[model samples]
Target: MPRIPLKYMLLPLGMALSACDKGLEEINRNPNASESVSPEFLLSSVLINTAYDYQREAYWEEPASAGRYITLVRNEDNDKFDWGPRGWDSYYARLSANREMMEIAGTMNQPEYIAVGKVLEAFNFAYITDLYGDIPYSEALLSKNEGIVHPRYDRQQDIYPALLNTLKEANNELSLLSRTVDATADPMYKGDALKWRKLANSLRLRMLLRISKNYAPAFSVMQEILNEPLKYPVFENNEDNAEIGYPGDIGVNSWPGGPLANAFAEFDKRKPSKEIVDALAERDDPRMEVWIAPVDDPNGGRMYMDDYVGVPNAIPAPYDYNGGSPHISRLSPMFNSNSHPMLKASLMTYTELCFILAEAVQAGRVTVAGKTAESLYYEAIRSSMRYYNVEGVADIRDYYNLPGVQYDGTREQLITQKWIALFLKGPEGWFDHRRTGFPQFTLGPLAASAVIPKRFIFPDTERAYNEKQYQQALVQFGEDRAGTLMWYLK
Candidate 1:
């Protein structure tokens, strides 16, 4: 599969809307996720919309920013640079939407709906809780009709199991599906159920491994995928990438297209950190040109600066990297002029899979008998390079036979590359960095979160609406702010 469509593999890429135009107007007693069922169809709508929603706000935006950040200021968001504001209401809203969608699926007999919904919901929750800490999951949405209006928060440690199980069940249901309504409403896969199944398993692999250091159970899960590659095939190329579609039609396109009225307004939003630049540079990675745009150095040839750190998080005016300084967080070649970080987003990539497996072998988690992890590691390196369609680079196939090769045995070797692999993919890098503390990134003088934030703070909106419950969760993580540590981080 192609690493990315280099297009909007739009999140919620499952269906086309309009069939269920009423939307939750009539929650079916037993809905089928395909066809005209409002609840089922909304699954795609809800999720695909989220990718857009995330781009529009910081909570969703922050996962990537947080993963990449050392320090920075939000020209538009005082809450971001301030390190407070209940963290991200955007995630909360997304989660609430997910819960409602899933609840509808559950009320109905839509097997695929429950299956996929669980995984997508888990995917969303991972970002939320990981960014914030203890959130109202177990007790959330009770006000709809339930008794407890103030549900206590669930710990992040507890949340991981659900993330795993959700994916596991998703894969299982997908494996046995008789047929799904052409997924006419689906945008992600263009109605392809088989592909969604692969994505489900792929996601399971990622989630299990995400909490690997903390969850001893991850060992078996990893082993299962290795044992059954055929049963759980992962995206082999960029084309199979879990991506969101970009409209590119001005406001309807992505955030980078126009002036975002956010805190990063005066500043350009999201640029490649010196971390990304230097890593690719040191490795002689050819994709640097593709990854970053040259600064306006009238000389024509780009100049490398000495900061060793990086420039302001953004500089966006005059319709270019014109306000540019350093690698303004670069845009994918797929993007035209608007470079909004939200213009397009990735859920996972084949490159990331290669990196994870490479690390797994390098770490002795997956033994390839006599073969050292060197090849896998190199394969990962090359596969990642290939993803950007750089002009030239060696392919992974060559590494299998190369001699004098050695596994990047150091943790740094595994993580640094992993971080790079994760760019535009998922915030997995940010989570990984928080868990393992790699790169020991240097922060800019004005960066927010000072260090990469481990979790997103609860939304201040919760304080007003779900105040009591929010406070109770605050106690679980030891802080009310998004930065609080959850079960595993502690």
Candidate 2:
């Protein structure tokens, strides 16, 4: 369990080009490739490769640019608020792999592989829809026989319900699995069907809770999970966390930015944002120390008021803060160094589930959850501290005494704390900030507009390749601008 073999992990995690190779043959399905590879083997490849991409792109890159935890000292386009184009093209590649896995599983009559494919496909589509709003879903991954080269977009309103059902179906199948792949094939849960079932339900909870504002059925689902927690099987502790382990020996699996990306390098221009530093400092949260290192002033001492001084977001290059140059605090060694190869790529965690429950309670969506919102909020805080390897329960307890940190049974309180806990994990913090509008962020000095971006622009390829469908979607969503609101956001 400690050292997953290289077969389970990978040097270049997403090196498999079967999907691309098949596509080049002018069809989605390749008879030769499908016959050569077992569905169980393809399942392993899709799971690891998708997890690796999620860790690199979604976990580190997207959230870093989103201005929640880290800020760029280079002060380029993303920092300046001219958010770049984000098409689902790369994600579609993963989805293509997933569809092939499911198809193969069906032909082979391996229910376990089929169930795993459903779960992974659900995971990818949820991420895709969340980021892009309406996207090609029902008709996607059908370009081979259906001749759906330009599939129409599925509204977020329609997509969530379908995704929830898909997750539910996957959970049912996983629970009934009498046999599964080898432990190596299931690196995340080591072929534990129960754990896989838990992850499926937990992810369903996450999706339901996210769209609960517009979708009222979420309350009943939450209540069902609460009334039968054992039956539902959500993440109970850090042990059930959906994290990917890195081998640290290879380029793809190694930490994002590698060894020299540590605090020692001159060109390592990333720093924690001042917003996060001030928030953690205000509550005397010990995780602040775990996140970043103190800056070394030229006078041979740390001249900062706070131990770590974060760079301001969206500021122009050569930006000055507090009359000092941009020698702001760098990320902690634990986060950036290659030495910590086992650095868990967090997909979801027990802490996040707790906060979701806390928010649901605060919203009065579910009254029979046993524990109140306040109690779950505290548990969420404690779990986050422990997950980050923060020492001393007393420090966490002391944080609770602070007016800013105390649970006030308010949505603001729940989301603000949840936002803090989600720091540097992924775009969840930024996404929650958008949904609840809590933990309000200040616009960087070079903001693109008065308001923050809502959604990323559709990629140029979509416009060029799928112009008819792409234009139709743009008109439906009301002009694919950053300011345009998605259905969920509305």
Candidate 3:
């Protein structure tokens, strides 16, 4: 009787609505809206964006043109070495996502995600420091949490060691076999934790070797990884390569220069550079056919010794060089397609690792049991051939035996082969060129700069928004110019 009286009284008075209003904020919240995103989703997004950016830098006109892999026939700022301050915004965007992923994973106690995040962070940071010399590291991505809007630029020397340490820590954390990763989230290795571990160690090797000339302990750190197979496993074969494939089903996910993403005329403007084309043609490299198309003859006759004709880089009116567009070789038709099996965005590869090891041995930095510099050198070339699907087409040994192709225990030979294998691999060829000066490049007659660029100048955003920090960085580093040598080079 009492319960009925209260319920009936509230219903009549409209006080029953008060009960529904309790926790109304929770109930009124949109179920479709996500207050927080999942770590896996963040990870997946970061990986895709990173891969696409990397592939673009590798295959697109700017970096490729700068690295002498291709020549831009029109709008040739990069070709003329008229590079301004290149931005690191895209890299920081991915790094910001990666930083968030790590934070959420930390709260969730997901060690695997944390480890993967560390690896990615190290990778991105390495590139940033390598390219720009000094960058925000210790205080970076702290605006939301620590309120550091203008993070100090960390020295490249200091950043390199920190990156190497981060990779080491990631490798140790990834050694835990009980932890699981989302297979779908990992575009490069498909949830293979061990492969990620290999990549961490392999990338460590790359970083170590990159700074070996300047960094004293690089060789010893490299030795530790090389000697320990089980603990510090590296890429054993091409299957262990850290590469991602484009779905190519949509404009956003398609290859950078592919038909879906770029116009045919834009693609046509990028012709193979004489530096790379002549190197391949002289060696009778099968990859020449895979990477470049045969030149179309105007008079129904071949223009060069081979049908392939590459344009001179940094030359005046490059569009008219080698007798206009029709006479010059375009990139292979495979590159023009929306997607192809060979069209992968590589983070690192076993071919590169082999070349790294070969260089290490030749330089007497580290030794592999039962392996000589020459053997690894040949293996490096063979792995490259196999990676390109040109292995079975010709006897690899014959190519190896050719003059300038044989192992001579010279750094030039080792790095030159690496440069060839590093085609379309994102700034690696240029990095090696800066490091070793192998496959020597010359400035064209019309080049704007007296010397090849060493590192990119700091972006305008940094100079504008973070003026104080930018000034401080320049005081420590030097004038903000592309020709200024970074710490590693110094």
Candidate 4:
């Protein structure tokens, strides 16, 4: 028997069909060509691709641009605010594979496999909707077979509820799977269904909190999950974090700009923004040292400065790319180095969950058995510090004693910490800033508009190919500008 590899990830719609035909031809006598590809391989490939998407690419784009977390001395398009419609065409491509995995899993009668697919489906949809407010949800990714090429765009308001439902139903299905299968392909949790279940519940909580400000019904959903802990287990600690692990030696698995990919990064043009460095410095935050490298200031000659400094966001050209200013710092060696191949692509962390719980409690959404908002807030900070091995227990305690670090019972405090903790994780910090308006970012002199960007423009592909649907969606939203506030923000 010949071994057929069944790897499914982000394949373009046209390419996917062509690949399927090729696979079918190769595996003669197998009418169900897809059966030659195991659901395990499909799940693994999707997980790997998703990790690479978040950790390598989006780390330097929307998330960095939105939060003023990193300064782009290279392309600087996102910096100068020359905003244009961004595409989710690749997301649709991935979803096609996702839909295939669901079909294969269903045919095998594997509830866990089906649940995992739904979770990924919901996650990608949520990510796209979060960035581009209204998007094609119900009728997307069905062009080749279903022939629904021009799918209607769904409102974010409607999309969020559907995503939440998908997650809820997925978690229920995951718990019902009794047979334990080898999950070596699962990089996030090693194919542990329980951990995935936790992630599902935690993600549901995250989505609910995201819309709770605008959608009151979300509060009820939050209450239902909080009311049942066993049914909806959340991240208990850093161990339960859903991060993609890297091999450190593998070219594909290492950090994007690290030493292994030196050609791609040339000592990295990306640096921490002044907003974050200054904030962390003021709080005497230890995480700063772990995050950034001292500037290689070329003042008459090259020399390293012990202090951390960063470039201001959205500044004009004639900028310093070669460390001309003493105030510009490079990224930390841990991130930029090739040695720490174990650097994870963080999807979600216990620290984030604690912060979410902290916020939920402040808003009277949920309550821990004996913990107060302050307790959870402090734990959240400690969990972040511990996760990164930034500070010792004593050092963490001392740092919390700083005037700004203590829990002030304000939502601003929770939001601020969460923003700092979410560096390079992709888009969540930006999303938080847009929704809460905390850890305030200033529009630089070169800003395209006076306001900070709220939502990403729908991709030009939609306007060009799916013109009617795109036009209807644009008209419903009023404008295609980056500064337009999304529904959730409103």
| Model 2 lDDT per residue over 430-489, tens place | 788778887888877687776667677778888889889988887778888777888888
Q: What is candidate 4's lDDT per residue for 1-490, written digit by digit as tens? A: 1111223233322243454466665665345434355677777777777766766655557667777788777777787667788878667766777787778777888767788888899988898888888889898867756999899988888999999999988889888888533467677787788898899999998999999878888777777887788988888998998887666575565677666655545446677877888888888887887788876653543233437777777776514633455546878887776446336777778888888889989877777777888999989888888877875942845988789887788988789989988777767788888888898777777767776688788887877898999899887776888888778888
The candidates, ranked best first by lDDT, are 3, 4, 2, 1
List candidate 3 stretches off by more than 4 Å. Answer: 1-28, 298-305
Root-mean-square deviation (CA) per prediction: 7.4, 5.0, 9.2, 4.0
Worst 10 residues of 3 by lDDT: 1-10
Runs with alpha carbons beyond 4 Å of true place in candidate 2: 1-35, 260-267, 298-304, 318-327, 339-342, 391-397
Model 4 lDDT vs. the true structure? 0.76
Q: lDDT of each structure? A: 0.58, 0.73, 0.83, 0.76
Better of 1 and 4 by TM-score: 4
Candidate 2's TM-score reads 0.89
RMSD of 1: 7.4
Candidate 1 per-residue lDDT, tens place, 42-143, comes to 666556666655544332355556666322333324213445664454555556656666666666766666666766777777767666666667666565
Clashing pairs in 4: 248-341
Listed in order, each prediction's TM-score against the native is 0.76, 0.89, 0.93, 0.90
Look at candidate 3 and give me any clashing residue pairs: none
